[model samples]
Target: MKTFFSLLQKKLFAENAPLVMLVGLCPLLIASKTLISGLVMAAAISSVLIFSCVVISLVRKLIPDNVRLVAYMIIIATLVSVAEIMIRAYLPTHYVNLGIYIPIIASAGIVFAQADNVASKNGIVVSVIDGTLTAITFSIVIITVSFLRELLGSGTILSHRMIEEEYGMSFALSGGGGLVILGMLAAVVKKINSIKKSKKEGE
Candidate 1:
Protein backbone atom coordinates (compact mmCIF):
# COMPACT_ATOMS: atom_id res chain seq x y z
CA MET A 1 0.00 0.00 0.00
CA LYS A 2 2.78 2.42 0.83
CA THR A 3 4.55 1.60 -2.41
CA PHE A 4 1.33 2.11 -4.34
CA PHE A 5 0.80 5.55 -2.82
CA SER A 6 4.41 6.48 -3.53
CA LEU A 7 4.01 5.49 -7.17
CA LEU A 8 0.83 7.53 -7.40
CA GLN A 9 2.58 10.57 -5.97
CA LYS A 10 5.43 10.21 -8.45
CA LYS A 11 3.02 10.02 -11.39
CA LEU A 12 1.15 13.09 -10.19
CA PHE A 13 4.21 15.28 -9.64
CA ALA A 14 7.69 13.85 -10.02
CA GLU A 15 7.08 12.03 -13.29
CA ASN A 16 4.17 14.01 -14.67
CA ALA A 17 3.23 12.74 -18.12
CA PRO A 18 3.35 16.07 -19.94
CA LEU A 19 5.79 18.08 -17.86
CA VAL A 20 8.36 15.42 -17.14
CA MET A 21 7.89 12.51 -19.56
CA LEU A 22 6.75 14.93 -22.30
CA VAL A 23 4.26 12.49 -23.74
CA GLY A 24 1.11 13.68 -25.54
CA LEU A 25 2.67 16.96 -26.65
CA CYS A 26 1.39 16.95 -30.23
CA PRO A 27 -2.25 17.46 -29.32
CA LEU A 28 -1.16 19.58 -26.39
CA LEU A 29 0.64 22.15 -28.52
CA ILE A 30 -2.09 22.32 -31.18
CA ALA A 31 -5.31 22.08 -29.17
CA SER A 32 -3.89 24.33 -26.48
CA LYS A 33 -4.38 27.44 -28.60
CA THR A 34 -7.41 28.20 -26.50
CA LEU A 35 -8.35 27.34 -22.92
CA ILE A 36 -11.57 25.59 -23.89
CA SER A 37 -9.89 23.60 -26.66
CA GLY A 38 -7.19 22.44 -24.24
CA LEU A 39 -9.76 21.36 -21.67
CA VAL A 40 -11.71 19.45 -24.30
CA MET A 41 -8.64 17.60 -25.49
CA ALA A 42 -7.55 16.85 -21.94
CA ALA A 43 -10.96 15.50 -21.00
CA ALA A 44 -11.16 13.38 -24.14
CA ILE A 45 -7.71 11.89 -23.61
CA SER A 46 -8.34 11.27 -19.92
CA SER A 47 -11.56 9.37 -20.55
CA VAL A 48 -10.00 7.24 -23.24
CA LEU A 49 -6.86 6.53 -21.22
CA ILE A 50 -8.67 5.56 -18.05
CA PHE A 51 -11.14 3.23 -19.73
CA SER A 52 -8.53 1.68 -21.97
CA CYS A 53 -6.17 1.00 -19.08
CA VAL A 54 -8.92 -0.63 -17.06
CA VAL A 55 -9.91 -2.87 -19.96
CA ILE A 56 -6.35 -3.73 -20.85
CA SER A 57 -5.44 -4.60 -17.29
CA LEU A 58 -8.44 -6.86 -16.98
CA VAL A 59 -7.46 -8.80 -20.09
CA ARG A 60 -3.66 -8.61 -19.75
CA LYS A 61 -3.14 -12.28 -19.05
CA LEU A 62 -5.29 -13.53 -21.90
CA ILE A 63 -3.30 -11.57 -24.49
CA PRO A 64 -0.31 -13.25 -26.10
CA ASP A 65 3.08 -11.67 -25.53
CA ASN A 66 3.98 -11.50 -29.20
CA VAL A 67 0.73 -9.83 -30.31
CA ARG A 68 0.36 -7.57 -27.27
CA LEU A 69 1.38 -4.41 -29.13
CA VAL A 70 -1.17 -4.99 -31.85
CA ALA A 71 -3.79 -5.87 -29.27
CA TYR A 72 -3.10 -2.70 -27.30
CA MET A 73 -3.49 -0.57 -30.42
CA ILE A 74 -6.84 -2.19 -31.23
CA ILE A 75 -8.12 -1.65 -27.73
CA ILE A 76 -6.99 1.96 -27.68
CA ALA A 77 -8.50 2.62 -31.10
CA THR A 78 -11.87 1.25 -30.04
CA LEU A 79 -11.95 3.47 -26.97
CA VAL A 80 -10.85 6.48 -28.97
CA SER A 81 -13.70 5.87 -31.37
CA VAL A 82 -16.21 5.85 -28.57
CA ALA A 83 -14.78 9.10 -27.14
CA GLU A 84 -14.74 10.77 -30.57
CA ILE A 85 -18.35 9.90 -31.23
CA MET A 86 -19.50 11.19 -27.87
CA ILE A 87 -17.54 14.39 -28.30
CA ARG A 88 -18.94 14.96 -31.77
CA ALA A 89 -22.47 14.37 -30.56
CA TYR A 90 -22.31 16.62 -27.51
CA LEU A 91 -19.55 19.14 -28.23
CA PRO A 92 -19.61 19.68 -31.96
CA THR A 93 -17.68 22.93 -31.84
CA HIS A 94 -14.92 21.53 -29.67
CA TYR A 95 -14.92 18.37 -31.75
CA VAL A 96 -14.23 20.41 -34.84
CA ASN A 97 -11.63 22.53 -33.10
CA LEU A 98 -9.76 19.47 -31.90
CA GLY A 99 -9.90 18.04 -35.44
CA ILE A 100 -7.39 15.25 -36.20
CA TYR A 101 -5.84 15.49 -32.76
CA ILE A 102 -8.89 13.74 -31.32
CA PRO A 103 -8.35 10.70 -33.44
CA ILE A 104 -4.61 10.86 -32.88
CA ILE A 105 -5.19 9.90 -29.28
CA ALA A 106 -5.62 6.37 -30.54
CA SER A 107 -1.87 6.29 -31.23
CA ALA A 108 -0.69 8.51 -28.42
CA GLY A 109 2.53 7.25 -26.84
CA ILE A 110 1.42 8.22 -23.35
CA VAL A 111 -1.55 5.86 -23.44
CA PHE A 112 0.40 3.03 -24.99
CA ALA A 113 3.36 3.46 -22.67
CA GLN A 114 1.13 3.31 -19.61
CA ALA A 115 -0.60 0.24 -20.92
CA ASP A 116 2.68 -1.49 -21.69
CA ASN A 117 4.57 -0.50 -18.57
CA VAL A 118 2.08 -0.28 -15.72
CA ALA A 119 -1.36 -1.54 -16.69
CA SER A 120 -0.31 -4.81 -18.28
CA LYS A 121 1.63 -5.93 -15.23
CA ASN A 122 -0.52 -4.48 -12.47
CA GLY A 123 -3.83 -5.28 -10.80
CA ILE A 124 -7.01 -3.65 -12.06
CA VAL A 125 -7.13 -1.16 -9.19
CA VAL A 126 -3.50 -0.14 -9.61
CA SER A 127 -3.92 0.27 -13.34
CA VAL A 128 -6.98 2.45 -12.82
CA ILE A 129 -5.19 4.59 -10.26
CA ASP A 130 -2.13 4.96 -12.49
CA GLY A 131 -4.31 5.91 -15.45
CA THR A 132 -6.30 8.44 -13.45
CA LEU A 133 -3.24 10.10 -11.90
CA THR A 134 -1.35 10.25 -15.18
CA ALA A 135 -4.38 11.75 -16.89
CA ILE A 136 -4.75 14.33 -14.17
CA THR A 137 -1.09 15.27 -14.50
CA PHE A 138 -1.40 15.63 -18.26
CA SER A 139 -4.57 17.69 -17.89
CA ILE A 140 -2.99 20.01 -15.35
CA VAL A 141 0.03 20.78 -17.50
CA ILE A 142 -2.01 21.30 -20.70
CA ILE A 143 -4.59 23.47 -18.94
CA THR A 144 -1.86 25.61 -17.38
CA VAL A 145 -0.17 26.06 -20.74
CA SER A 146 -3.47 26.88 -22.40
CA PHE A 147 -4.36 29.42 -19.73
CA LEU A 148 -1.05 31.19 -20.09
CA ARG A 149 -1.08 31.11 -23.88
CA GLU A 150 -4.63 32.38 -24.12
CA LEU A 151 -4.02 35.12 -21.58
CA LEU A 152 -0.75 36.32 -23.09
CA GLY A 153 -1.63 35.85 -26.75
CA SER A 154 -5.30 36.81 -26.81
CA GLY A 155 -5.46 38.95 -23.69
CA THR A 156 -8.44 36.94 -22.54
CA ILE A 157 -9.32 34.16 -20.18
CA LEU A 158 -11.76 31.72 -21.70
CA SER A 159 -12.47 34.33 -24.40
CA HIS A 160 -13.78 36.93 -22.00
CA ARG A 161 -11.40 39.69 -23.14
CA MET A 162 -9.80 40.79 -19.92
CA ILE A 163 -7.53 43.45 -21.31
CA GLU A 164 -8.97 46.62 -22.85
CA GLU A 165 -6.60 46.51 -25.81
CA GLU A 166 -4.77 43.66 -27.48
CA TYR A 167 -1.71 44.15 -25.32
CA GLY A 168 -0.71 40.48 -25.34
CA MET A 169 2.10 39.34 -27.58
CA SER A 170 0.85 37.86 -30.86
CA PHE A 171 3.69 35.34 -31.01
CA ALA A 172 2.61 33.76 -27.76
CA LEU A 173 -0.48 32.33 -29.46
CA SER A 174 1.43 30.59 -32.22
CA GLY A 175 2.52 26.93 -32.21
CA GLY A 176 6.21 27.85 -32.10
CA GLY A 177 5.49 30.13 -29.18
CA GLY A 178 3.75 27.28 -27.40
CA LEU A 179 6.86 25.15 -27.69
CA VAL A 180 9.05 27.86 -26.26
CA ILE A 181 6.74 28.35 -23.33
CA LEU A 182 6.54 24.64 -22.68
CA GLY A 183 10.29 24.32 -22.71
CA MET A 184 10.72 27.20 -20.31
CA LEU A 185 8.09 25.74 -17.99
CA ALA A 186 9.79 22.37 -18.10
CA ALA A 187 13.11 23.94 -17.23
CA VAL A 188 11.57 25.75 -14.30
CA VAL A 189 10.07 22.54 -13.01
CA LYS A 190 13.39 20.78 -13.36
CA LYS A 191 15.15 23.51 -11.47
CA ILE A 192 12.65 23.34 -8.64
CA ASN A 193 13.05 19.59 -8.41
CA SER A 194 16.79 19.93 -8.33
CA ILE A 195 16.57 22.42 -5.53
CA LYS A 196 14.36 20.11 -3.48
CA LYS A 197 16.72 17.22 -4.07
CA SER A 198 19.70 19.26 -2.96
CA LYS A 199 17.93 20.36 0.20
CA LYS A 200 17.05 16.78 1.07
CA GLU A 201 20.67 15.73 0.61
CA GLY A 202 21.81 18.51 2.93
CA GLU A 203 19.33 17.39 5.58
Candidate 2:
Protein backbone atom coordinates (compact mmCIF):
# COMPACT_ATOMS: atom_id res chain seq x y z
CA MET A 1 0.00 0.00 0.00
CA LYS A 2 2.80 2.35 0.88
CA THR A 3 4.57 1.55 -2.34
CA PHE A 4 1.39 2.07 -4.28
CA PHE A 5 0.86 5.47 -2.74
CA SER A 6 4.46 6.40 -3.42
CA LEU A 7 4.10 5.46 -7.06
CA LEU A 8 0.92 7.51 -7.30
CA GLN A 9 2.65 10.52 -5.79
CA LYS A 10 5.51 10.19 -8.24
CA LYS A 11 3.16 9.93 -11.17
CA LEU A 12 1.25 13.01 -10.05
CA PHE A 13 4.25 15.23 -9.35
CA ALA A 14 7.75 13.85 -9.80
CA GLU A 15 7.12 12.07 -13.07
CA ASN A 16 4.26 14.15 -14.39
CA ALA A 17 3.24 12.95 -17.84
CA PRO A 18 2.99 16.23 -19.70
CA LEU A 19 5.71 18.21 -17.97
CA VAL A 20 8.20 15.41 -17.46
CA MET A 21 7.57 12.83 -20.11
CA LEU A 22 6.27 15.41 -22.61
CA VAL A 23 3.69 13.11 -24.12
CA GLY A 24 0.41 14.06 -25.76
CA LEU A 25 1.57 17.46 -26.88
CA CYS A 26 -0.67 17.42 -29.94
CA PRO A 27 -3.84 17.98 -27.94
CA LEU A 28 -2.01 19.99 -25.34
CA LEU A 29 -0.89 22.53 -27.91
CA ILE A 30 -4.07 22.68 -29.98
CA ALA A 31 -7.00 22.38 -27.55
CA SER A 32 -5.39 24.55 -24.90
CA LYS A 33 -6.34 27.86 -26.44
CA THR A 34 -9.17 28.20 -23.91
CA LEU A 35 -9.70 26.84 -20.43
CA ILE A 36 -13.04 25.27 -21.29
CA SER A 37 -11.68 23.50 -24.35
CA GLY A 38 -8.59 22.38 -22.48
CA LEU A 39 -10.69 20.98 -19.64
CA VAL A 40 -12.98 19.18 -22.05
CA MET A 41 -10.05 17.66 -23.92
CA ALA A 42 -8.42 16.62 -20.69
CA ALA A 43 -11.60 14.98 -19.48
CA ALA A 44 -12.01 13.05 -22.70
CA ILE A 45 -8.43 11.88 -22.66
CA SER A 46 -8.66 10.93 -19.00
CA SER A 47 -11.80 8.90 -19.48
CA VAL A 48 -10.34 6.96 -22.38
CA LEU A 49 -7.04 6.38 -20.60
CA ILE A 50 -8.65 5.15 -17.39
CA PHE A 51 -11.09 2.80 -19.07
CA SER A 52 -8.50 1.52 -21.53
CA CYS A 53 -6.01 0.86 -18.79
CA VAL A 54 -8.55 -1.11 -16.80
CA VAL A 55 -9.59 -3.21 -19.76
CA ILE A 56 -6.01 -3.81 -20.90
CA SER A 57 -4.85 -4.82 -17.46
CA LEU A 58 -7.72 -7.25 -17.13
CA VAL A 59 -6.87 -8.92 -20.41
CA ARG A 60 -3.11 -8.58 -20.31
CA LYS A 61 -2.52 -12.18 -19.51
CA LEU A 62 -4.65 -13.40 -22.39
CA ILE A 63 -2.81 -11.37 -25.02
CA PRO A 64 0.24 -12.80 -26.68
CA ASP A 65 3.45 -10.93 -25.92
CA ASN A 66 4.23 -10.35 -29.58
CA VAL A 67 0.88 -8.87 -30.45
CA ARG A 68 0.41 -6.82 -27.28
CA LEU A 69 1.08 -3.51 -28.98
CA VAL A 70 -1.56 -4.16 -31.60
CA ALA A 71 -3.96 -5.31 -28.93
CA TYR A 72 -3.35 -2.18 -26.87
CA MET A 73 -4.00 0.03 -29.89
CA ILE A 74 -7.30 -1.69 -30.53
CA ILE A 75 -8.35 -1.35 -26.91
CA ILE A 76 -7.42 2.32 -26.84
CA ALA A 77 -9.30 2.94 -30.08
CA THR A 78 -12.45 1.34 -28.70
CA LEU A 79 -12.29 3.38 -25.52
CA VAL A 80 -11.62 6.56 -27.45
CA SER A 81 -14.65 5.82 -29.59
CA VAL A 82 -16.81 5.49 -26.50
CA ALA A 83 -15.37 8.73 -25.17
CA GLU A 84 -16.14 10.43 -28.48
CA ILE A 85 -19.77 9.29 -28.33
CA MET A 86 -20.15 10.47 -24.76
CA ILE A 87 -18.55 13.84 -25.53
CA ARG A 88 -20.66 14.34 -28.62
CA ALA A 89 -23.84 13.55 -26.71
CA TYR A 90 -23.12 15.60 -23.62
CA LEU A 91 -20.89 18.37 -24.97
CA PRO A 92 -21.64 19.03 -28.57
CA THR A 93 -19.76 22.29 -28.65
CA HIS A 94 -16.65 20.67 -27.26
CA TYR A 95 -17.07 17.79 -29.63
CA VAL A 96 -16.94 20.18 -32.54
CA ASN A 97 -14.19 22.24 -31.01
CA LEU A 98 -12.02 19.23 -30.23
CA GLY A 99 -12.72 17.73 -33.67
CA ILE A 100 -10.02 15.34 -34.83
CA TYR A 101 -8.01 15.56 -31.61
CA ILE A 102 -10.51 13.37 -29.79
CA PRO A 103 -9.86 10.49 -32.12
CA ILE A 104 -6.14 11.24 -32.03
CA ILE A 105 -6.11 10.28 -28.37
CA ALA A 106 -6.22 6.66 -29.41
CA SER A 107 -2.69 6.95 -30.71
CA ALA A 108 -1.37 9.32 -28.06
CA GLY A 109 1.97 8.32 -26.66
CA ILE A 110 0.89 8.96 -23.07
CA VAL A 111 -1.97 6.50 -23.34
CA PHE A 112 0.11 3.88 -25.09
CA ALA A 113 3.01 4.33 -22.69
CA GLN A 114 0.83 3.56 -19.71
CA ALA A 115 -0.82 0.69 -21.56
CA ASP A 116 2.49 -0.86 -22.43
CA ASN A 117 4.63 -0.09 -19.40
CA VAL A 118 2.14 -0.14 -16.52
CA ALA A 119 -1.16 -1.74 -17.44
CA SER A 120 0.40 -4.64 -19.27
CA LYS A 121 2.49 -5.55 -16.23
CA ASN A 122 0.58 -4.40 -13.18
CA GLY A 123 -2.62 -5.60 -11.57
CA ILE A 124 -5.92 -3.96 -12.38
CA VAL A 125 -5.97 -1.73 -9.31
CA VAL A 126 -2.46 -0.44 -9.89
CA SER A 127 -3.11 0.07 -13.57
CA VAL A 128 -6.24 2.08 -12.83
CA ILE A 129 -4.38 4.21 -10.34
CA ASP A 130 -1.58 4.79 -12.81
CA GLY A 131 -4.02 5.79 -15.53
CA THR A 132 -5.90 8.15 -13.22
CA LEU A 133 -2.72 9.80 -12.00
CA THR A 134 -1.40 10.15 -15.52
CA ALA A 135 -4.65 11.73 -16.61
CA ILE A 136 -4.57 14.11 -13.66
CA THR A 137 -1.02 15.09 -14.49
CA PHE A 138 -1.95 15.74 -18.09
CA SER A 139 -4.94 17.77 -16.98
CA ILE A 140 -2.97 19.86 -14.57
CA VAL A 141 -0.32 20.81 -17.10
CA ILE A 142 -2.70 21.50 -19.97
CA ILE A 143 -5.15 23.47 -17.85
CA THR A 144 -2.35 25.54 -16.41
CA VAL A 145 -1.08 26.25 -19.91
CA SER A 146 -4.58 27.06 -21.11
CA PHE A 147 -5.16 29.43 -18.26
CA LEU A 148 -1.96 31.28 -19.06
CA ARG A 149 -2.60 31.35 -22.77
CA GLU A 150 -6.20 32.49 -22.50
CA LEU A 151 -5.37 35.12 -19.94
CA LEU A 152 -2.40 36.37 -21.94
CA GLY A 153 -3.59 35.86 -25.48
CA SER A 154 -7.24 36.79 -25.27
CA GLY A 155 -7.27 38.96 -22.15
CA THR A 156 -9.82 36.55 -20.69
CA ILE A 157 -10.07 33.50 -18.53
CA LEU A 158 -12.57 30.81 -19.43
CA SER A 159 -14.18 33.26 -21.86
CA HIS A 160 -14.65 35.89 -19.18
CA ARG A 161 -13.29 39.32 -20.02
CA MET A 162 -10.64 40.22 -17.49
CA ILE A 163 -8.97 43.25 -18.95
CA GLU A 164 -10.60 46.42 -20.19
CA GLU A 165 -8.11 46.81 -23.03
CA GLU A 166 -6.28 44.43 -25.37
CA TYR A 167 -3.37 43.65 -23.12
CA GLY A 168 -2.99 40.06 -24.29
CA MET A 169 -0.50 38.83 -26.86
CA SER A 170 -2.12 37.13 -29.82
CA PHE A 171 0.84 34.84 -30.42
CA ALA A 172 0.25 33.01 -27.18
CA LEU A 173 -2.90 31.59 -28.69
CA SER A 174 -1.02 29.78 -31.45
CA GLY A 175 0.45 26.29 -31.51
CA GLY A 176 4.00 27.57 -31.80
CA GLY A 177 3.37 29.85 -28.85
CA GLY A 178 2.13 26.91 -26.85
CA LEU A 179 5.28 24.98 -27.59
CA VAL A 180 7.39 27.90 -26.39
CA ILE A 181 5.40 28.20 -23.20
CA LEU A 182 5.57 24.47 -22.63
CA GLY A 183 9.30 24.54 -23.11
CA MET A 184 9.70 27.32 -20.56
CA LEU A 185 7.50 25.38 -18.14
CA ALA A 186 9.65 22.30 -18.61
CA ALA A 187 12.77 24.31 -17.89
CA VAL A 188 11.25 25.71 -14.73
CA VAL A 189 10.26 22.27 -13.53
CA LYS A 190 13.74 20.96 -14.25
CA LYS A 191 15.27 23.80 -12.25
CA ILE A 192 12.95 23.16 -9.32
CA ASN A 193 13.81 19.49 -9.31
CA SER A 194 17.47 20.30 -9.37
CA ILE A 195 17.05 22.60 -6.41
CA LYS A 196 15.22 19.91 -4.48
CA LYS A 197 17.90 17.38 -5.30
CA SER A 198 20.62 19.73 -4.11
CA LYS A 199 18.75 20.43 -0.88
CA LYS A 200 18.35 16.75 -0.17
CA GLU A 201 22.00 16.12 -0.84
CA GLY A 202 22.98 18.96 1.47
CA GLU A 203 20.73 17.61 4.16
Candidate 3:
Protein backbone atom coordinates (compact mmCIF):
# COMPACT_ATOMS: atom_id res chain seq x y z
CA MET A 1 0.00 0.00 0.00
CA LYS A 2 2.79 2.43 0.89
CA THR A 3 4.64 1.69 -2.33
CA PHE A 4 1.42 2.05 -4.31
CA PHE A 5 0.72 5.49 -2.90
CA SER A 6 4.31 6.56 -3.46
CA LEU A 7 4.20 5.54 -7.11
CA LEU A 8 0.81 7.20 -7.50
CA GLN A 9 2.20 10.46 -6.15
CA LYS A 10 5.12 10.30 -8.60
CA LYS A 11 2.82 9.60 -11.52
CA LEU A 12 0.44 12.42 -10.65
CA PHE A 13 2.95 15.22 -10.00
CA ALA A 14 6.53 14.24 -10.82
CA GLU A 15 5.73 12.86 -14.27
CA ASN A 16 3.21 15.21 -15.82
CA ALA A 17 1.91 13.78 -19.10
CA PRO A 18 2.13 16.92 -21.22
CA LEU A 19 4.90 18.87 -19.57
CA VAL A 20 7.22 16.08 -18.51
CA MET A 21 6.27 12.98 -20.48
CA LEU A 22 5.58 15.19 -23.54
CA VAL A 23 2.92 12.95 -25.02
CA GLY A 24 -0.45 14.11 -26.40
CA LEU A 25 0.88 17.29 -27.92
CA CYS A 26 -1.29 17.46 -31.02
CA PRO A 27 -4.55 18.00 -29.17
CA LEU A 28 -2.85 19.98 -26.44
CA LEU A 29 -1.43 22.47 -28.93
CA ILE A 30 -4.30 22.69 -31.39
CA ALA A 31 -7.62 21.86 -29.71
CA SER A 32 -6.60 23.69 -26.57
CA LYS A 33 -7.26 27.07 -28.20
CA THR A 34 -10.03 27.66 -25.72
CA LEU A 35 -10.80 26.61 -22.17
CA ILE A 36 -13.91 24.62 -23.13
CA SER A 37 -12.15 22.91 -26.00
CA GLY A 38 -9.32 21.89 -23.69
CA LEU A 39 -11.73 20.58 -21.07
CA VAL A 40 -13.60 18.55 -23.66
CA MET A 41 -10.37 17.09 -25.00
CA ALA A 42 -9.28 16.22 -21.49
CA ALA A 43 -12.60 14.52 -20.74
CA ALA A 44 -12.56 12.67 -24.02
CA ILE A 45 -9.02 11.36 -23.55
CA SER A 46 -9.58 10.58 -19.88
CA SER A 47 -12.59 8.39 -20.66
CA VAL A 48 -10.77 6.47 -23.38
CA LEU A 49 -7.62 6.03 -21.30
CA ILE A 50 -9.41 4.83 -18.18
CA PHE A 51 -11.86 2.42 -19.80
CA SER A 52 -9.33 0.99 -22.22
CA CYS A 53 -6.88 0.44 -19.40
CA VAL A 54 -9.52 -1.41 -17.40
CA VAL A 55 -10.52 -3.57 -20.34
CA ILE A 56 -6.98 -4.29 -21.42
CA SER A 57 -5.79 -5.08 -17.94
CA LEU A 58 -8.69 -7.44 -17.35
CA VAL A 59 -8.00 -9.32 -20.57
CA ARG A 60 -4.24 -9.14 -20.54
CA LYS A 61 -3.73 -12.82 -19.89
CA LEU A 62 -5.96 -13.79 -22.78
CA ILE A 63 -4.33 -11.58 -25.40
CA PRO A 64 -1.43 -12.72 -27.52
CA ASP A 65 1.74 -10.67 -27.49
CA ASN A 66 1.84 -10.38 -31.25
CA VAL A 67 -1.75 -9.14 -31.56
CA ARG A 68 -1.91 -6.92 -28.48
CA LEU A 69 -1.15 -3.75 -30.39
CA VAL A 70 -3.99 -4.37 -32.79
CA ALA A 71 -6.28 -5.19 -29.88
CA TYR A 72 -5.39 -2.02 -28.02
CA MET A 73 -5.96 0.12 -31.11
CA ILE A 74 -9.35 -1.44 -31.73
CA ILE A 75 -10.42 -0.90 -28.15
CA ILE A 76 -9.21 2.70 -28.06
CA ALA A 77 -10.81 3.54 -31.40
CA THR A 78 -14.11 2.09 -30.27
CA LEU A 79 -14.06 4.09 -27.06
CA VAL A 80 -13.19 7.27 -28.95
CA SER A 81 -16.08 6.71 -31.33
CA VAL A 82 -18.47 6.34 -28.43
CA ALA A 83 -17.12 9.50 -26.84
CA GLU A 84 -17.56 11.46 -30.08
CA ILE A 85 -21.18 10.40 -30.48
CA MET A 86 -22.11 11.22 -26.91
CA ILE A 87 -20.36 14.58 -26.98
CA ARG A 88 -22.00 15.50 -30.27
CA ALA A 89 -25.39 14.52 -28.88
CA TYR A 90 -25.07 16.21 -25.49
CA LEU A 91 -22.44 18.94 -25.85
CA PRO A 92 -22.82 19.98 -29.44
CA THR A 93 -20.74 23.11 -29.07
CA HIS A 94 -17.82 21.36 -27.46
CA TYR A 95 -18.14 18.51 -29.90
CA VAL A 96 -17.83 20.89 -32.82
CA ASN A 97 -15.07 22.84 -31.15
CA LEU A 98 -13.05 19.69 -30.50
CA GLY A 99 -13.61 18.72 -34.13
CA ILE A 100 -11.29 16.02 -35.48
CA TYR A 101 -9.16 16.02 -32.37
CA ILE A 102 -11.70 13.88 -30.56
CA PRO A 103 -11.34 11.16 -33.14
CA ILE A 104 -7.59 11.61 -33.24
CA ILE A 105 -7.37 10.75 -29.59
CA ALA A 106 -7.45 7.12 -30.66
CA SER A 107 -4.03 7.53 -32.24
CA ALA A 108 -2.69 9.91 -29.61
CA GLY A 109 -0.17 7.19 -28.55
CA ILE A 110 -0.42 8.25 -24.93
CA VAL A 111 -3.48 6.07 -24.34
CA PHE A 112 -2.23 3.06 -26.26
CA ALA A 113 1.24 3.38 -24.75
CA GLN A 114 0.01 3.31 -21.19
CA ALA A 115 -2.55 0.61 -21.84
CA ASP A 116 0.01 -1.52 -23.60
CA ASN A 117 2.93 -1.07 -21.26
CA VAL A 118 1.41 -0.69 -17.80
CA ALA A 119 -2.05 -2.16 -18.17
CA SER A 120 -0.84 -5.24 -20.00
CA LYS A 121 1.57 -6.03 -17.19
CA ASN A 122 -0.31 -4.86 -14.10
CA GLY A 123 -3.41 -5.88 -12.18
CA ILE A 124 -6.75 -4.19 -12.75
CA VAL A 125 -6.51 -2.00 -9.67
CA VAL A 126 -3.03 -0.79 -10.50
CA SER A 127 -4.04 -0.11 -14.09
CA VAL A 128 -7.06 1.87 -13.00
CA ILE A 129 -5.06 3.97 -10.59
CA ASP A 130 -2.39 4.61 -13.22
CA GLY A 131 -4.96 5.54 -15.84
CA THR A 132 -6.85 7.86 -13.49
CA LEU A 133 -3.72 9.65 -12.31
CA THR A 134 -2.32 9.99 -15.82
CA ALA A 135 -5.58 11.43 -17.04
CA ILE A 136 -5.66 13.84 -14.13
CA THR A 137 -2.11 15.03 -14.75
CA PHE A 138 -2.80 15.45 -18.45
CA SER A 139 -5.97 17.36 -17.68
CA ILE A 140 -4.20 19.70 -15.29
CA VAL A 141 -1.53 20.74 -17.82
CA ILE A 142 -3.85 21.04 -20.81
CA ILE A 143 -6.49 22.94 -18.84
CA THR A 144 -3.93 25.35 -17.44
CA VAL A 145 -2.47 26.04 -20.89
CA SER A 146 -5.96 26.57 -22.30
CA PHE A 147 -6.93 28.90 -19.50
CA LEU A 148 -3.81 30.96 -19.98
CA ARG A 149 -4.17 31.02 -23.78
CA GLU A 150 -7.83 32.06 -23.73
CA LEU A 151 -7.15 34.70 -21.13
CA LEU A 152 -4.18 36.16 -22.98
CA GLY A 153 -5.40 35.71 -26.54
CA SER A 154 -8.96 36.89 -26.14
CA GLY A 155 -8.74 38.64 -22.79
CA THR A 156 -11.56 36.48 -21.49
CA ILE A 157 -12.09 33.75 -18.99
CA LEU A 158 -14.30 31.05 -20.42
CA SER A 159 -15.46 33.49 -23.11
CA HIS A 160 -16.48 36.12 -20.61
CA ARG A 161 -14.69 39.36 -21.32
CA MET A 162 -12.20 40.02 -18.56
CA ILE A 163 -10.15 42.43 -20.65
CA GLU A 164 -10.74 44.31 -23.84
CA GLU A 165 -9.79 42.31 -26.95
CA GLU A 166 -7.67 45.22 -28.11
CA TYR A 167 -5.50 44.76 -25.05
CA GLY A 168 -5.31 40.99 -25.25
CA MET A 169 -2.33 39.39 -26.93
CA SER A 170 -3.85 37.95 -30.06
CA PHE A 171 -0.65 36.04 -30.74
CA ALA A 172 -1.50 33.74 -27.88
CA LEU A 173 -4.18 32.20 -30.07
CA SER A 174 -1.69 30.97 -32.65
CA GLY A 175 0.35 27.75 -32.68
CA GLY A 176 3.54 29.65 -32.11
CA GLY A 177 1.94 31.17 -29.06
CA GLY A 178 1.01 27.76 -27.76
CA LEU A 179 4.59 26.63 -28.18
CA VAL A 180 5.80 29.61 -26.21
CA ILE A 181 3.44 28.81 -23.37
CA LEU A 182 4.42 25.14 -23.50
CA GLY A 183 8.08 26.02 -23.33
CA MET A 184 7.56 28.24 -20.30
CA LEU A 185 5.55 25.55 -18.60
CA ALA A 186 8.23 22.96 -19.35
CA ALA A 187 10.80 25.25 -17.79
CA VAL A 188 8.69 25.65 -14.68
CA VAL A 189 8.25 21.90 -14.35
CA LYS A 190 11.99 21.38 -14.79
CA LYS A 191 12.74 23.92 -12.11
CA ILE A 192 10.35 22.27 -9.70
CA ASN A 193 11.94 18.90 -10.35
CA SER A 194 15.36 20.34 -9.68
CA ILE A 195 14.15 21.80 -6.40
CA LYS A 196 12.70 18.46 -5.39
CA LYS A 197 15.95 16.73 -6.31
CA SER A 198 17.93 19.14 -4.19
CA LYS A 199 15.62 18.59 -1.23
CA LYS A 200 15.91 14.83 -1.57
CA GLU A 201 19.67 15.04 -1.75
CA GLY A 202 19.80 17.23 1.32
CA GLU A 203 17.62 14.84 3.29
Q: Model 2 misses residue 81 by how many Å? A: 0.5
Candidate 3 per-residue lDDT, tens place, 117-165, comes to: 7899999998998998888878888899999999999998887999887
Q: Judge candidate 1 against the unseen true structure and give its global Cα lDDT, from 0 to 1.
A: 0.89
Candidate 2 regions exceeding 4 Å error are 1-9
TM-score to true structure, per model: 0.93, 0.94, 0.94
Question: Model 2: clashing residue pairs?
Answer: none
By TM-score, highest first, what's the ranking?
Answer: 3, 2, 1
What TM-score number comes out for model 1? Answer: 0.93
Clash pairs (backbone) in predicted model 3: none
* Candidate 2 residue-wise lDDT, 62-164, digit = tens: 9999998999999999998999999999999999888898999889898999899999999999889888888888888889999999988998987789975
| lDDT of model 3 at position 55 | 92
141 Cα displacement, candidate 2 (Å):
0.4
lDDT assessment of candidate 2: 0.88
| Model 3 poorest 10 in a row by lDDT | 4-13
Q: Which one wins by TM-score: 1 or 3?
A: 3
